[model samples]
Target: MKQHHVWTWPIAGYLFLGGLGAGMSIVCAVADLFFGKGELLGLAPLGALLCLCLGSGLLIFELGRPLQFWRVFSTQRAVLTFGAWMVILLVVFDALYFSFFSGWFPWSAAAGARAVVAVIALLLGLGVLLYTGIELSSMKARVLWNTPALPVLFALSGILTGVAGDYLVCGLWPYGGPAADAEALAGILRPLMAGLAVATVVSLLLYVLMMYTSSNPTGRTAATRWLRGSYALPFWLGAVAAGLVLPLLLLILGGMAAALGALLFIVGGVFLRFLTVYSDDRRELAGERERLLKLPHGDEPFLKSNWG
Candidate 1:
C-alpha cells in the first residue's frame, strides 16, 4: 500500500457536484409541485445529467484507460451503472422536457405530467445525494468522513451548488430574453434561485453544527481544518460570503443584483467544492495515520500486550 495519500481531483469535484445536483434537482421538483411549476426548473433538470456525465467523464479523464474503467461497471454492478434502463429513463425525461420547450409537445404536457414527474424526480434525486453521502461515511480510513452528518451535509451542499448552476444558465441566456423558448423559464428564475439561496443557508448552519458537535477528535479536527484552518478562505469567503450571502441579497433585491449574485454563487460553489474535497481527503489520511500510530510497537508492544 502507498504510505502517503493523494486522491484524484475527480473524486473531490464530482462527489460534491453529485450531491449538489441531487439536492437542487429535488428542491426544484418539490417546489414545482407545491407552488406550481417553475419553467426555470426545466433548466435544472439537466444538471444531474450533466453532473453525472461530467463526473463519469472526469473519472475516465483521470484514468486515461477506458477499458479498465469499463470493466468496473461491466461486472454485476454494470446493470446498475451502465444499464440501459437508467440511461433510457433519463433520456426519456430529458427528451420530453426538451420536446416541451421546443413545442414538440404541447404546453399541456408540461403542466399535466409535471406533478407526477417532480415527485419521482425528488425521490431519485435524494437517492443520488444519499449514495454520495454513504460513500464518504463508509470510508474507514477517513474517520472524519465516517460521520452521521455527511449525507445531509453533502446533499445540502449539492442543492446549493445545483441552484447556482441553474442561475448560471439563466444569467447567460437571460431566459426569455434569448431567441429560444425559455421565456417560460423567466417567471421561475426568481423563486428557483431563491430556493437555492435557502438551501445554501440551511446547509451552512447544518455544517457549523456538524463540525463543533462531533463526538470524536478525528471528526472535530477535520471539521476544524475545513472551518478554520487551511480550507478556511474558500469555506468562509467563497462558500459562505459569495455563494450564500450574495445570492440571498440578489433574491431579496432582484434585477442586476440577482444576476450578479448568480455569477458569484456559481464561482463560490465551485471553489467550495475544492475546500470540501481537499479537507475530506486530508481528514481521511490523518485519521489513518493516527490509528497506525496508536498500534503497539517496539518496546511498547510488551507493555501493551495484555490489558489489566
Candidate 2:
C-alpha cells in the first residue's frame, strides 16, 4: 500500500504541544477557580504559554508557505481559521493569567480580577483542546479520522497529558515554588492523574475498537495497523504501556515512581499524536488499487526513455 505523507511529524508535534498546553491551562484554571490552588499551580499556565507558542511555531513550520500563515485568518469560516483564532486567544488569556501569578502588576493581588482572567483562560483553553481533535475529524476523506469518537478520545488524552505535566512541574520540580505548596499540590494531583490515566486508557481502547469494527475498510486497516500490524509496537508500548498503564501503576506506588510515571505519560502523549497522524489513511475508492497497479513503474523501460 502506498503511504500518505500529506501530514507528518510537524503536524503531530503541533497536535501534541497544542493539546498539552491547552490541557495545562484548563487544569490551572480549575485549580484556581474552585480549589484556590491556582496560585500554587502557577507554573502550569506559564508552561502552557510556552507549549502554545512552540506548537504555533511547529504549525507554521508545517505550512508550505510559512509566511502566508496569516491567510488562515483571512476567512472566518474554515476550521483551521477558527483554530488559529483559538490559539491566539488562548495565548493572550493564558499570558495574562500567568502575569498575575508572576506578580507583574500590583493589581495581580486582586482575587476578583485574577478569577475573571482565569475564567476566560479556562474557556479559551477548552476551545483549543477541542479544536485539536475537531481539526482532524473534520477531514472527511480520511476515514480513520472522520469519527465523533476521535474528538472525545483526544479531549480525554489532552486533559490526561495536562494533568501529567502539572504533576511533573508543580509537584516534582524542586524549585517550582514553596515546598509545602508543592507537596500539597502533589497530593491533589496524584489521584487525579490515576483517574485521568484510567479514563484515557478506556477512551483509547474504545476509539481503536470502533475503528477496527467500522464499516469503512480504510478505517479498519488503520486500526489493524495499530493493533497488530506495522504500528502495533508503538501503539502498545509507547501509548498503552508506557503512556497510560505504567503511569497509572507508578502513580499508585507514589514517591519517585509517580514522577517517572508522569514523565512517561507526556512521552506517551507524543507517541499518541504521531501514531494517529501517521495512521490517517484516506478511504480507497472502488478499483483505486487496481487502477494504480496498472500505472507504469518508474523503472519501466518505456517510462525511463524520454518522450521528447
Candidate 3:
C-alpha cells in the first residue's frame, strides 16, 4: 500500500484553531446563560468568529485551489467534505450572532432570535471540534489515528484550550469591569483549569496506551515513535510537560499565575497539533520493510540493509 502525507501544518492549524473556537463558543454560551457573566459573553462570540475565520482560511489555502473549495460543500464522504461545510456554516452563525449582540445588527433586541443563532453556532462549533478527530481517524492509512480515543482526546483538548483561552482573555480585558471582577472570574476559572487539564492529560495517556497495545506492527511503531524515538523529547516536553502538567500546577497557584498557565496551554495545544501531524508513520510499515529485506537479500544476512 502506498502511504500519502496529504495533511501538513495548514491542516494542523485548522484542527487546533477550529477546536479552540468551538470550545470558546460553548463556554461563552454556557457562562452567559447559566452564570450570568455578562462581562465575559462578548469574548466567546468574538473568539469563535476569529478562530473560525482564521482556521477556515488556512484550510482553504491548504487546498491549493481556492476556487474548488466549494466542492467540499456539495460532497459527502465520511467527515472530510462534511467538515468543510461545518466550518463554513459555523462561521456564518457565529458572525450573525456576534453582530446582533454587539449592536452591529439592528434587530439585536430580539432575545429569541439571538438565542437561536447562539445555539446553532455552538452546536456547529462542537461538531467541527469532533470532526477534526473523526476526519483523522478516517485515514485508515495512519496507524496512530485509527483509535476511537483520538476524537475524545481532541474534544477534551479543545475544551481544555478553550477554557484556558477564555481565562487569559477575561483576565486581560475585564469587559470594563473592575479589578475585583477579574479576580472573581479567575476564581471561577481556577478549578476549571485544573479539571480540564487533568482530563486532557488522562485522555492523551489512553490514546498512546491504545496505540502501544495494538497488535499491528504499524501501531506499535507509531507508539514507539513517541515513547523513545525521534518524537520523544517534544512529545514529553511540549505536549505533556508544558501543555498538561505546567498548566495544571500554575492554575493551582491562581491569581497572575493562572494567566501564565493559560498561555502555556495555548502553546501546548499548538504543539500537540503539530506533533500529531508530523509524527504519523506514513513511511513504509515494518512488515513491508521485513518483506523487502527478505526478497532482496535472501540467504545472505550480511548483504541485508540494517534499515530497521
| Highest-scoring model, lDDT | 2
Name the weakest run of 10 consecutive residues (lDDT summed) in model 1.
Answer: 170-179
Return the TM-score for candidate 1, rounded to 2 decimals: 0.68
Residue 139 local lDDT, model 1: 68
Cα displacement (angstroms), candidate 3, residue 199, comes to 1.0
- Tell me how many residue pairs clash in candidate 2: 0
> lDDT for model 1, on a 0 to 1 scale?
0.60
**Each model's TM-score, in the order given?**
0.68, 0.92, 0.86
- The reply for model 3, stretches above 4 Å from the true place, is 1-4, 75-77, 171-174, 282-308
TM-score, structure 2 vs. true: 0.92
Q: State the RMSD for candidate 1.
A: 8.5
List lDDT for all candidates, in order. Answer: 0.60, 0.87, 0.78
- Clash pairs, candidate 2, are none
Per-residue alpha-carbon lDDT of candidate 1 for residues 4-120, written as tens digits (9 for 90 to 100): 334457767666656656655665676467755445455566656676567656656666576576565444643235322333344345434434433445563556676666666
Worst 10 residues of 2 by lDDT: 169-178
- Candidate 1, residue 24: the lDDT equals 57
Report the C-alpha lDDT of model 2 over 1-308, residue by residue, as the tens digit.
37447799989999999999999999989988999888777778889989999999999999999999988888678888888998988999888888787776888778888899999999998999999999999999988788888888888889989988888778432234568877888898989988888888998999899989988788888999999999999999999999999888888888889999999989999999999899879978799888878766666676558662
Per-residue C-alpha lDDT of model 3 across residues 38-101, encoded as one tens digit per residue: 3555656777779878998898888878878877777567587788878888878877766655
